[model samples]
Target: MPRATDAPPTATPADAGPAGGDHLGHGLRTRHLTMMGLGSAIGAGLFLGSGVGIATAGPAVLVSYAIAGVLVVLVMRMLAEMASALPASGSFSVYAERALGRWAGFTLGWVYWFTLIMVLGAEITGVARIVTGWLPGVPQWGVALVVVAVFAAANLAGVRKFGELEFWFALVKVAAIVVFLVLGVLLVLGLLPGTDPVGTTNLLGQGGFAPEGVGGVAAGLLVVVFAFGGIEIVTIAAAEARDPQRAVGRATRTILWRILLFYVGSVAIIVLVLPWDAPVLQEGPFVAVLDVAGLPGAARLMEAVVVIALLSAFNANVYATSRMVYSLAGRGDGPAVLRRVSRRDVPWVAVLVSVAFGVVAVGLNWALPDTLLGILLNAVGAALLVVWVLVAVAQLRLRPRLEAEARARGEELPLRMWGYPWLTWATLAALAGLVVLMLADGTARGQLLATAGLVAVVVGIYGVTALVRRRRAAA
Candidate 1:
């Protein structure tokens, strides 16, 4: 059990280049980090995807969201504890390397990178579809291509500029949700101009709150769990903040409660306002609520907001995937060329390579216009589960050492896990249960199998590469 400092350095001096160095720029501020987390977590999942959850479990979908929300809060706490102690662009991947081994780090890094890449494809495709609705003649793939290009350019500009753009994007999402929540509450209470009290009709009357029973709740959990995937970007961005430890601590603390409110609150409102079986739920839950509230042109307005949400998420995922690959390269797990940085302290090569899949997905949109998003979503659903499992394991193994080090230095840890070992273990068990649930459901089983295949491929590649390098050195 070697300590993090005792482990071999993930990056070496040789990795540094003349152009701004190999290191990522510390350009993110506390506000930027906080909003990026919000921007990432609140995207397609809530706006467009939650409808699937409601449809699956009826109002009992709240149970699914609550379960997922609690899991995210615990996982983020574990991640924040580790990130505050040892922040890096790789974030949990770096921690996994130290606490588990290089193999774990390599597998987690590559798996997470691929996961975000798939998510990038989904986000851009989602946005392109929404945009095409506004301009019927524009080709969806064309819009996807333009979006991929715009975000690529924005990411290449530098971290600060990227952070500023994400800040505003997330702000718009948060504001829209706030207004929606207020309107929902007013409408439910019969406070809106011409509306009567909706009462508990939607909640209790909707197939007795669990239309499909426990099986449906399980299915809903599978659908909604992935919504919490992007919140980890906060920990990743912490590496680039002016003060990683302080900024990460603050951001993680506030983000947990906010996410719960936004996700759980919004879902509750939707189910309370509209029938769980409403056909409009499939279209867009947020928009459906607004439309039912009698707001003029609510459909168009919310559709526009959803486009922004998808774009915001697309931008954040681009940043996350590029940094993950850049970190992987720096650590010798990926190609060394990805370590190259631009004059603005941006990982130019990694940014380009990361978005390359989005470009490919543009073609997929053109080819498989109807089914591309569902395919991508199902493929990547279980990836976050794997990543979170690793994060918890890494924290479990590292927390004791971190505490010992803090004690030796006569200081308290900047941020501590809420209930170490106990809560950490509980979170792991909950994640395992989610995996079991995924296996039980037919659709989720496919996603779990796909993610399993991806992880196996990554692990096999890493193992073979390591053996080759070892033999080469011996020869």
Candidate 2:
């Protein structure tokens, strides 16, 4: 028997919508989604955090990207199926509600919400620190507050404005990477006008590509997965797209592969240009590479680009967190006040709530500056893992039912995962492997444990909520 949370095969409010029958305006188009996805995944992680991985694993970091990239592809394939078919405001959480039940939905929704709200501060903190490089006199907390205010307004104005802003933000990031890739090939081939070919000396010289060995590659894989965090935002934004079904399908299809290109390609270029043992690996890999190339003013240019990228993520997360809160509120899982929308059909209360929570994160960063912030960041790290697990599970449960419906209707699904049950199972196994890797890696162990403890509390809250609902129903 189907649970109440699982809607029938026929399209529900999310799929059969005047923008999912929610108050949000449906102004986003295919272009916005494509660019948004492109931009979201290419932020501070690539610009700054890649250094940590490259320095740790040396040239073997490429292998880490390949490993994590495969998992992201599988997860997105599963996501495209559910999102294209269902198309909800809350996305994975809504899918979970239908496939796994209300408890699952509530759990995923709030967990993700908490993660975004917390990451919001971190993104702002990244922006603050990055900008400080350019203007050393500014206080980090002040910059954080200013950016939070600026992007918060951008989010509240309207979904369309947010989409447009993301489109440009993503375009700048894409252009920068494409230029880097071109210059990279030129350098390798010794075709950069006056420069001699650096060739593959770095790749071979660095202790035969796996200098840190397989164990180092495993550790790097954990960091690489974290880099892939923001790619899922396109699906989350799918509910607001003009053609939710087609928009999500196209975005999902195009976005993930491009991410692999940028990430893998960029990492390849960096390693080729600079040896893994290079001291520059301690900072932004892009900056380190450009500085090695001796391009005039490269350092300042790289710093500016990175600051823009971090702020872009800050804007995207602001939009995502608010929408998630609104989605939950609309479904009666969150406080009713968060469900309130404005004349523009924007969730005003939800935006305020998210920004308010972000303020708390900012304060924590300012106050503790060390211990508590680490715990907060690590807690959010496990969020993407839980989300991907639920997304795959939801698709696995929903697939057979969806196929049966499509056959009855004499039509094919707009998007389908190849190898169905088998592929789905394989993806789950792969995710399990990543989790085990997290357990094995000493550096990642704390994050895994912290995230697990956070999940326990959320699950416990759901248990109590379910018990109360049952008791009230019995009366």
Candidate 3:
């Protein structure tokens, strides 16, 4: 198939204002991109969802996390290479179009947008529940509506304002994780006042590592892999950065080790400090660790942090979904109205349309709290995997052309994926293996099937639309 041409590799400072061409505002600084990468990924998945992985695989959950972390690193490295070379709001979806075809980009973009919309609903619902816990008289749906409204207004303000808001929100999350890691290390070493060395008792003592065996570790992998989902927002956000190449390079390089440290490091600490079978793991592993360390008000502090994490993720997702649809509209794959921008260069129509689901979902949550939300969330469980697989595939297809273009220009690419075809192939293999595992696991099977159905629907729509356009031209 003939490849689509790449987006021009041009960038302007975020302060360039409305003069920065007909595109999303370049309002994100390096700090905003960096912190957004961190904050976006470290959400309820780590604080609340990780315990399920631990319960499934014992201390061997670290292996699951390690595998997933390495995959993310490889995937990000590939994305950094493409994103730096051809920065665009569409990010990997654009790369898919260039490397594969328009159909690939259209499918990936719409599916990802749908995934984020569903996630926005879940995030708002989670945040609302947390707030309702603190203020009992407040209704959950009311809190959800207010939270959605506030974030939507913040996003509509302007890209700079949104970047600044995300920067501060992410800072809170990163600081919380750093503090937790520091305290966890001290507590483990018996350095905390009045604590004995925990040693490796909890890690090896509880059913000897892989108690549930390889099957358990595989189950754990399924649980923790999706935790890495939101980090891809960095690439999407990179298009809005003052210097896309520099910002993407720095963020992708550092995000890997930081996520590994935050995720694998934190998980290692949790298992080392507390037995895998401890009932408290189910409640919240980080909070449980602090409680064990005898930190006063640990539960409340962690609860507040979890709320912050969810809100931060919600804010980032709003930015990501809007940019993606705006990119689609710009390419004539979506409604033309979605391409409208404000004086501040914000895609106002796209922003509102992206968050529209959250508003409707609030009512859905209020009406059918149990069934509808779970089905929506579950349907998108495997969406990130689909996106990652496309990123790897697009990188594989585009790398040679990119390298040749770089040589023709007498310059080197801004970033290159380490090991090229070898590592990229390995990442694809691992992703395929993950799909097999998901298919085999009863709980994950439904999600995988649902996602496949979503992909099919997207492709079908693209096909029908293409046929209609061709017929109209012929007529």
Task: Please give the ranking of all candidate structures by lDDT, highest first, separated by commas.
Answer: 1, 3, 2
Give lDDT tens digits, candidate 3, residues 159-255: 8999899889988888898999999999999999889999988999868989899999999999999898888888888888888878889998888
Cα lDDT tens digits for candidate 1, 181-233: 99999988999998999989999995788989988888888888878878899
**Model 2 Cα lDDT, one tens digit per residue, 56-156:** 78899999999989888999888888777767678888888878888888899888988887788777777776676668887777777888788889888
Which clashing pairs does model 1 show? Answer: none
Candidates 1 and 2, the one with greater lDDT: 1
Superior candidate under TM-score, 1 versus 2? 1
| Candidate with best TM-score | 1
All-Cα superposition RMSD per candidate: 2.4, 3.7, 3.6
Error of 1 at 89 (Å): 0.4
Q: Of the candidates numbered 2 and 3, which has the greater lDDT value? A: 3
